[model samples]
Target: MALKLRLKPCERVVINGCVVQNENRRYTLTISNFAQIIRGSDILQEEDAVTPVRRAYFLIQSMLLDPTIAANGSGAAAEMMAQLYTTFTRPDIQDRIARAMGHIGERDYYKALSALRPVMEYEGTLLSPAPSASAPSFQTEGLDLHAGHHAGG
Candidate 1:
């Protein structure tokens, strides 16, 4: 589905020039390809960024297969990219990714992100908000913070 993606350690990439069905078979093929990429690339040797990436991809695949993620309209897709962010080239890549994920359960995001940065950039779309979800909520009304109530007591 031609996705834009960002990976850890610094780089950008696109994914799926080839057609991919939203089925287990397709996902399995994708993961298998990913595994091969891992085997081929020397991502692991560079700054401790392999284990987490592999785990994150596993989690992403799991999320994509979930009906809830699919029903929510690209929740799975966002999560998938977010997972990749965990594997930054820098050491704190994991922490940053975890914070970005927020309430989402921990799944070694940092490690995974570091490892998959290349893959995401190569094969997926950049991370973006899900299609179905609304924008983040704001507490104050529009352009009237002092109008409705006194500021400074």
Candidate 2:
């Protein structure tokens, strides 16, 4: 299979750890061989990796850049995931982590990264400051409101 990329002017991509930039015009490239490729849009900056999920994404991205360090990267990601498991008990977060783990087990950093993407957005939601008195609660939704002896008993 081939990976086709259509980049805009001044766009950049990381191909097998090398950063390549397009000129001031549209450019297209078809990659025929298996190579690690990450577009600028998907790149996570070190400074921006503040949350646990972001840090995991960054580590996996590093694996994409340098496949040789996958073991170290996986270890770091696993440590972070352990902490995250205790911190976030939501079903959705758990599901995403499980999926990412499967991909990681296969040494498919790209798919692992994709699996974590939703968890990243979820982390943002979890961390977003509550501005009002009626802020959202992190507790399992219906378990609090409907799962009780009070509702039916």
Candidate 3:
């Protein structure tokens, strides 16, 4: 007697306006201005309210796990490196990944450590990914809270 196995087709992922299609759904592509969506999907199994700190932690972890990020020679040691780079360089994204990091660190050391490992590894490289033609331009002319809110969000 003989047995047969079956397989299903893979779904394509559209991220940061780039569509990466592959038969294997193992790899993740990290792009600017869209990490949140990817991270949220990857980290959250079900939809529910999550604190920014928790979201930030999960987001950084997801980025670190991405093959693209790991291939850049930035290993597990630099999980939150992606977020730190974005915070200082862009400083305009609606997400407060940096502030969330601080809050998590203040309240939970383990969570903070998990988030900071990446940042510590590539301190020098802690600059945001440069704006590409594909990226949207900054909107905040002023640095006030209201202005920052508009630009950041």
Candidate 4:
């Protein structure tokens, strides 16, 4: 099946490890064969990869964007993935990461990226502090509650 892509003006896409930017106008493209493709929005910047899972994601992104890295057999991506596997013990996250690894091994970078999305989101939840149970809820009982209502009433 062919993939149909409709790109906005000036939008960029990485196809087969090459960065291609759209012209000043919107354009549509149809890809008929097997190729690596990533939209600009989905690309992860290096500085944005602050956590272990993010780092792993960045590595995977790098592999997909750069053919040399993917061809040279760099173990860095695998090493980082292994570290993440050890750090995250949740069965669901582990499964996603493992599936991503399988996709990587199969050279299916897009599928690997899809599998890693939930793992990254789960990592974010784990790293973020949970809302405090004792936090006070906002109440409109006391101050100026009638003042605003009177103007509209």
Best by TM-score: 4
Q: Write the per-residue lDDT of candidate 2 for residues 1-153, one digit (tens) a residue.
A: 998999999999999889999999999989998777888989899999998789889988888888677756787777877776677788888888888877777877777788888889988988998689887678675655544657456
Give the lowest summed-lDDT range of ten residues in model 2.
143-152
The per-model lDDT (C-alpha) reads: 0.40, 0.84, 0.39, 0.86
Candidate 2 scores a C-alpha RMSD against the true structure in Å of: 12.1
What does the lDDT read for residue 42 in candidate 1? 26
TM-score: model 1 vs. ground truth: 0.23
Which lDDT tens digits does candidate 3 get at residues 1-153? 321212223544433324445465354344433221222233332142143333444444433345453244233323443444454544432133454345343433234434443433343344336657888777766747455567557
- By summed lDDT, which 10 consecutive residues of candidate 3 come out lowest? 33-42
| lDDT order of candidates, top first | 4, 2, 1, 3
**Residue by residue across 1-153, what tens digits does model 1's lDDT show?**
432222333232222222222322212222423211222132233333235444445444333334354245345535654655644544455544554355234332234444445554443333443566667777885677666577574
Runs with alpha carbons beyond 4 Å of true place in candidate 3: 1-43, 46-56, 59-88, 108-153
Give residue 103's lDDT in candidate 2 (0 to 100): 78
Candidate 4: stretches off by over 4 Å: 23-27, 133-153
Question: Which residues of candidate 2, in runs, are more than 4 Å off?
Answer: 85-87, 133-153
Whole-model lDDT, candidate 1?
A: 0.40
Residue-wise lDDT of candidate 4 within 1-153, one digit each (tens)? 999999999999999878899999989999999899999988889999999888878878888888887876437777877787888898998999889888888887878888899998998898899899898898877678566568556
Question: 2 or 3, which is superior by lDDT?
Answer: 2
Give the Cα-based TM-score of candidate 2 against the true structure: 0.75
